[model samples]
Target: MPGFPRRLTSRAAAGLALLPALTILLVAHLGSTSWTIWISLTSSRMLPNSNFVGLRQYETLLNNDRWLVSAQNLAVFGTLMVVGSLLVGLLLAIAIDQRLRVENTLRSIFLYPFSMSFVVTGLAWQWMLNPTHGIQKLVRGWGFETFQFDWIVRQETVIYTLVFAGIWHAAGLVMAIMLAGLRGIDEEIWKASRVDGIPAWRTYVSIVIPMLGASFATAGILLSASVVRLYDLAVAMTNGGPGLASEVPAKFVMDHLFERGNLGLAAAAATSMLVTVVSIAAPLLYARSRARTAETRR
Candidate 1:
């Protein structure tokens, strides 16, 4: 018999290597998602039942006040968290990159929060923001009788507290991304800009930002995914308290799944979220594909 061709042997080895990953992906991720979609169409109770209910679950979910509020909260939280984390993180990265003293120490200090479980950090934030025990009480003890930082207890502003802690936890990741991008910049660009008498701010705004597009894209995508799946921090900190002002979509789905025992509704909410994500992402993806095609043609 003729020996196997080298290319055929290489292909067979590659296929073998991919088999485990493909199996896991098919069983765990794709299989679960398909199950979710199917269950959404069924009248599943506490556990998944086989009774088909058509689009009734979707209709019920659409009519749910709590689900609607959760979606709204998610929108607000996602917007604020993404924008705030990116801006602050970029600034922090730039400052640290300036050859400052104790750069590693400062970097570690900022990144430490990311390593912590939200259970610990969120409780700490809750304590710090508590009206009777936290910043307000400390300030009152300092002789200022009217210093009020009680937004944490208010229905209107409690979501902002989530944004604050979310930013604290997330900014480090963004900073790391930006720092990597900044380090990859050609040193000669800085030298040339300096010799041209361009201000540091101008150079960063016009030159550095444009070149760091890949880094920003990476950070933005990561942050957006986190925003969509926000639950742990909210649970640990506010528990969707102050009249559901801090509720988010992930929490809504989880609540319906486990707490409310409405798997059908839960699946409906999850499906809605998936639709929203696709709606937003589709245009961006199309634009990217077009850009890549144009670049190739050029």
Candidate 2:
């Protein structure tokens, strides 16, 4: 007993060690969120003020055409990016899981893009997608003079281009997630499928994918967060250009908060984003918790 460490003492010491970090997080992040929410309810513009004008900013934000466009753009981008990334990532993971001779090399190449900053990814994709000196020109030079790959410059298609770049950047991360899930799968599943005359694709589609719920959830959460704060990619690639065609909510908030000196509107937009994320996430988290509780009872 003399040589043993007391559990209460250890726990107390750990809590004490974490106290500073916990305090900082509460003050910095929580305080900032509360402040933003409060600001959104007020008439603050160009600077903070105590003048309370509740919901005015929200009403204005709802009416703003640019804001509506940004929301629509985000909706399109989020849907396409998430679906495309998941599909491409799953395919890549399945391919790499085949235990090819160059599996590691291929995985490294696939995951390399995720390691790069969004700015770098955006710029690289931008240069490659540029109409004048990029793919279109290169293809035209090769004899197909009418080949049109100028999506980046078209207002209707620029957002799709962003989605493409986003998928290219995020698919590797999703692949890494899916690959881990694939590897954790029991080998017997494969043997059983082979014996039962089930194709590998069918096994993956029905059984393997269903079993990888946690992996999919984890990847979805990460990708969803990226989708919410999509700023740098849009900035570096299109700068919300071709007449606000590729504008996203984050960029709208940034432009209002910084460039346009509309702090109240920006805060409202930020608060709306926060509320939307919470609205979606809270239910999922609650359901997950309920499921775990039921499992425990069983």
Candidate 3:
């Protein structure tokens, strides 16, 4: 009973210390999200007038062809970007783990692109992919006039260029992550596999990859957020063109909120995107939390 007051006092002190953060969470995050939701429910335009109109903005947003196209582009882009980055990163990580002579140089070369901002990545790729002034011109000058590598200006294939640039920028970070995970793996496991005469590639595919679940999850979540929040890249590269070919949800929301001067519709689009991300992420986070708890208990 004598320890109860001390424990109580400690808990109280901890709570008091966290009060500022709690207040910020309530006001900054919840309050802002609530306001955005309310805006979506209204007939807001350039000005945030409070004329309530339930679900109308969302209906209009769903019907809009640009929004639909943007959503479609996001699905394709996100899938390819995630898969491509993960594969490229994992391969780089494995190569580095092989004790290459120039490991540091190779790692830096791969990672250099990730240190750049999306704006820079997009602009650089835009120049490199330019049909007349870039790769195509350079190649043709070198005696290959029939060679065709221009996809950025073509509406049907512009999105793939975005995916290529995105994966290029992102793969290095994923490689770093996967390499860290690979390092943590017990050397004993490798020795055991060697003792069993298992082939290296088969071991990596069958056992090592399964063990890197945490790294994979981390990279996946990071890439997912980038996919949802993608704006700068699209803006810099195509400006959502070759006629909305590379448009994404974040760009769609920005266009309506500012350029289109329709806050209600923008809010609706924003809320939908937010909800989609949260829905996908929440379950994974919860499962991770439960796994951690179970491991602790064990």
* Candidate 2: regions farther than 4 A off: 1-12
User: Residue 192 deviation, candidate 3, in Å?
Assistant: 1.0
Candidate 3 local Cα displacement, residue 118, angstroms: 0.2
RMSD of candidate 3 to the truth, in angstroms, is 2.3
lDDT of 3 by residue, 171-247 (tens): 99999999999999999999999999999999999999999999999999999889888999999999999988889
Q: Report residue 256 deviation for candidate 2 (angstroms).
A: 1.0
lDDT of 2 at 54: 91
lDDT of candidate 1 over 1-298, digit per residue (tens): 4556977899999999999999999999899888999999999989999899899999998898888888888888899999999999999999998988998899989888889887787899999999999999999999999999998889899999999998999899899999999999999999999999999999999999899988888999998988898898889999999888888889999998999899999998898899899999999889988998999999
lDDT of 1: 0.91
lDDT of 2: 0.95
Please list the C-alpha lDDT of all candidates, in the order they appear: 0.91, 0.95, 0.95
Give the poorly placed runs of model 1, Cα more than 4 Å off: 1-13, 296-298
RMSD of each predicted structure: 1.9, 1.8, 2.3
Write the number of the candidate with greater lDDT, choosing between 1 and 2.
2
